[model samples]
Target: MEASELVQRFVSRMAEGQPIHTASRLLDELREDLIKIGRRSAFFESQGLPLQEAWVGIKFGEIMTFDTIYLAAKAQMGFDVVLLKDNVSVQFDITEATDRNVDRAEEYRSGPEMIVEDSGEIARQESLFEKNVGNRLKRKSSDNLIVYVNTGWLPEEKFIEDALIRWHLSFKKKFNSAYLLIRGSVVQLAPELQKFSNSRSRENGPKS
Candidate 1:
């Protein structure tokens, strides 16, 4: 199939159906893009998230359609995906905060030259979200921010909650809400931490 057809397939399946459970099918359809992924595939592989799954379009297909939260894909202007339910629609940006500072997902699709100053600095000077959030925050969180916090980038349970709490609190401008995806469990952390909000406060710092 042509490259354009692959994208069309992705749109047709994900725009109206349950793509949450259909990740593999989308991966297969879009697998050719893996060859395009090329050099950066190793970095993603080391992170334990294969190029097929980590690819931008494929990631959108997965974890997007499992619940009542309907995701209608949008253009670059705003709201990467819009939530539709009943008679209301909410804006959401499905973004990633990976271990590496670069937005490799966009690089893969747009074919830009990537720069890596120091691999040793990965997640050292700042948390995953902090490094990448600066650009995304230009909108200042008008749209709901749904982040895929790659495991290599962050940590488990409480540690992640703490990082998110610290990251969210540090910024005067913040997301309408922030949701973190770690190890298959989805945790909402901003505006509120669902269960942890009461225990957390701006003064609290994340564990190093």
Candidate 2:
């Protein structure tokens, strides 16, 4: 609860005991998870498989947050948060899960932000969902996607699963998963998207 008491109470009042995660919190959680994932072998691994102790360590370098340099990053890494780590650095394209299928570009052109406004105007640009799904999911640097909805979203149920399926088939990319943070909830969206093999496309894929 590094955030002020008012922020905590504001979240609690909106979603009960469940705290709504902001962009800053989401970035921190991902950073911690990447480190802990390296230590999974210390406990349980995937099913019977365990992470090897020799391959357990992962070193992270300086982190690039989308706080002030988001516009600058658009020309380089192009992701909201660029986490530099050993081996290959991980890139994240963070966006606000707009209440509609279309993106509110004006509100979020500067990358994902702490938007206090409720859903209203939204226009389509190059939405993350459209860029990386179905046959288009095989790009080299699509980047891990994170979409979060603000606390102001009402229960209109705009971003439903069925619509995602249609959008999934139209696009093409090998993005494994898209993480969605709705108010105080977190969902791993589109894990069942078709396979993205090295050579062939749309064979079979699994969400982790």
Candidate 3:
């Protein structure tokens, strides 16, 4: 199916209360389609560059992350309803996912970050997840953490190692999954996430 069609179908399934796994699979397909589209953009096509080269364009961002997670929650978790309070901005976006039957609500805060060059900057991202992990663990109702990192602009090494480490050690268990916005695609940090990272590390090699 086309990317747009798949996206609509995903939203429809969420509204109709389909399985979260099913919705997530559709989104996984959607991400691939989007990457294909990015490959065809004029800049990449004209230069005969790989589709991977076009990932830093405007189409890739954290908004894509929210759509995947929110839809999955609506279908998978008991969150039958969702509310969007505002447009996504540089600061952050707020969303509320609620299961009225259980009187439970999860407040999600999501935004995009450019992984910093200095390792010290890792603390900034970790601090955000750390605060939310505490709340998520204590709550039976809602999971309050959602973070999306845009790695297209990162140096390949930082993209693979530092980014994966932060997600694996700190955010993985607490958030179910954290989204990584890379190469103009949003991916759940699944098992394949590590495999993909390792391959890229090999391809990029050590810095001169």
Ranking by TM-score: 1, 2, 3
Residue runs of model 2 more than 4 Å from their true location after superposition: 1-72, 83-89, 97-141, 151-159, 165-174, 193-208
Query: Would you give me the overall lDDT of model 1?
Result: 0.43
| lDDT tens per residue, model 2, 1-208 | 2223323333233222111124334333433453454531222232222111101101011111122111113335465444332334445565433323432223222223233234442212123334433223333244465444332332123433444556454332445555444333334444444311122111111111
Cα deviation in Å at residue 154, candidate 3? 3.8
Error of 3 at 107 (Å): 21
- Provide backbone clash counts, one per model: 0, 10, 0
Write down the worst ten-residue block by lDDT for model 3: 102-111
1-208, model 1: which lDDT tens digit per residue? 4444445555555555343345444544455454464432433232322222223323332333323233353443455554444545556666654444454443333211223235455334245445554344444455466665443422333434455576666442466676654433455656766532221111111111
Q: Evaluate model 3: give its TM-score.
A: 0.27
lDDT of 3 by residue, 1-208 (tens): 4544544554555444323244445544545655666531232122322112112111222223223223333324443233222433221122212112221111111223355557665565444333443333334233332222322233244434544555465444555433343333334443234322322222110011
The 10-residue segment with the lowest total lDDT in model 2: 52-61
Best by TM-score: 1
What are the lDDT scores of the predictions, listed in order?
Answer: 0.43, 0.31, 0.33
Task: Name the candidate, 1 or 2, with the larger TM-score value.
Answer: 1
